[model samples]
Target: MEHAIIIVVILTGLGAVFGLILAYANKKLALEVNPLIHVVEDVLPKGQCGACGFAGCMAYAEAVVTRPEVAPNLCIPGKDPVAKMVAELTGKAAEAVEPRIAQVRCAGSNEKATRGFKYAGVSDCVAANLMFGGDKTCKYGCLGLGTCASNCPFDAISMSEAGLPVIDPEKCTGCGKCETVCPKKVIAMMPLTARVRVNCNSRDKGQVARKACSSACIACTLCVRECPYQAVKVENNLAVVDPSVCVANNCTDAKCLAKCPTKAIRPAVLGIVPGAEDQAAVERACPSCIKTNTAAG
Candidate 1:
């Protein structure tokens, strides 16, 4: 009993000494963190979307505060308002952040796209893609499994009734999370001002692409011939639109939209139908086209 008591007292003394030593060492060896980092982080949107090229919001705050070269407008989701705040806080010149939105490049809804077989395995797109490039006949098209919708951090993407993902432009922060998570690479980031887009991703030959998905771009080149500004072209059996050329030429007539045989080229804005008689729909789809038509009339 006496020996046990002595042993306990020795252990207690050793623990007390080690505790004191660790506390002192921690204080002496600790690196002083800049309070400005916390201040910057607090001002951030706290989305942790990595739109700023950092791992998260806190990492971005640290980089922008510590590094002189990191730009204040790197936060894409925050847009101009957040850029202004970040610039004011860091004393950096604020650059305008061009707003962008996520666009699903595929128009292959379940009704339009033919299925190779029924998918019976995992719900994840990555897992499904490993099994014969998913059940879709068009390997490059969306799987309609809600992978992009599930992975989107902003909740801007939702699975439509047609078994395809629909993006809400207002809710999308252009974080590129959906684009990254898409196994088929059908999701992409587009400029918010974009007036038109090619809604197909399949590079299969015209007949094969049509067999797979009725709405697939057949690479017919009709759009190419119809476009007056040389903004559309056929590349790798797929129609590609040069938005820069379209913007520079102010080619808002959307001739490509009218000429696409499969309706592969579509208005960038969702819920707007091309050639619809509704004036509001026409304006929403292509405002500049309406203005030009009105002037001509």
Candidate 2:
């Protein structure tokens, strides 16, 4: 009994000594965090959505405090409002942060796209993509599985009936969360002031694209021809909008909107609601699916 008691006493003494050493070591090795980091962080939204390309608000705050060129206004979700707040806290000028929104480039819905097969697996876009690209015949269309909608922290993206994401600009703070979750990379971030966007992301040839999805851009170059400001450009067999010039163009005559066979070119000013339906019937249902399918064939 005496031996056991002595052993216990020794162990307790050793533990106490180790504890003291650990405390001293921690005090010596601890990182000196700036008091201003907390101040800057307090002003941040703490969404940690990585809109600023930092791991979190704390990371951005660290960079802002330590570095000079790391602008405090890179936070997209925070927008200009947060940028100004951060700048005030860090004693820096707030850079101009143009508000941006997430856009779904794919118009290929179940109604608009021809499916090669039916998906019956994990029911997620990530999983569906592993098994031969996706269920949709179009190699570059949304899987309509709502992975993006599910991952969105602000509930900005919602799945429509025909299998496409509908972005609520009001809810979306341009967090870029939806853009990251999308496996197809069909989503893009454009300036809120942008008045036009190419709704299609397909890089396939015209005939090949038509067989996969009816709404796929055929690379017709009509938009390039119609734009008065020289804003539109045909690249990679797809039309792309130069956001810099596009936001300033007066091309809202509905000319490009009309000439687009697939209605892929939507005016950003009119606040185009990206839908699964065709350009005209996008707001409603297809007036010519059954009868028209028979007539066309």
Find the candidate with the highest lDDT and give its number. Answer: 1
Compute each candidate's TM-score over C-alphas: 0.89, 0.86
Would you list the C-alpha lDDT of every candidate in the order shown?
0.83, 0.78
Q: Tens digits of per-residue lDDT for model 1 on 63-128?
A: 999999999999988999989999999999988988888888888887889999999998888999
Residue 204, candidate 2: C-alpha displacement in angstroms? 0.9
Q: How far off is residue 104 in model 1, in Å?
A: 0.3
**Can you tell me which runs of candidate 2 are displaced by over 4 Å?**
1-7, 269-273, 276-297
Tens-digit lDDT track for model 2 on 1-297?
Answer: 999999999999999999999999999999988899888888787777887888988998899977888898987788888889888888889869888889889878778789889889997999999989988888888989999989887888888776788888778888898889889999888887665667788899988888888888999988788666777788889988787775565333434444567667765532233543344442122233334445756
- Give the CA lDDT, 0 to 100, for residue 84 in model 2: 91
Candidate 2 minimal-lDDT segment of 10 residues = 281-290
Model 1 stretches with alpha carbons more than 4 Å out = 1-11, 271-297
Scored against the true structure, residue 266 in model 2 reaches a CA lDDT of 64
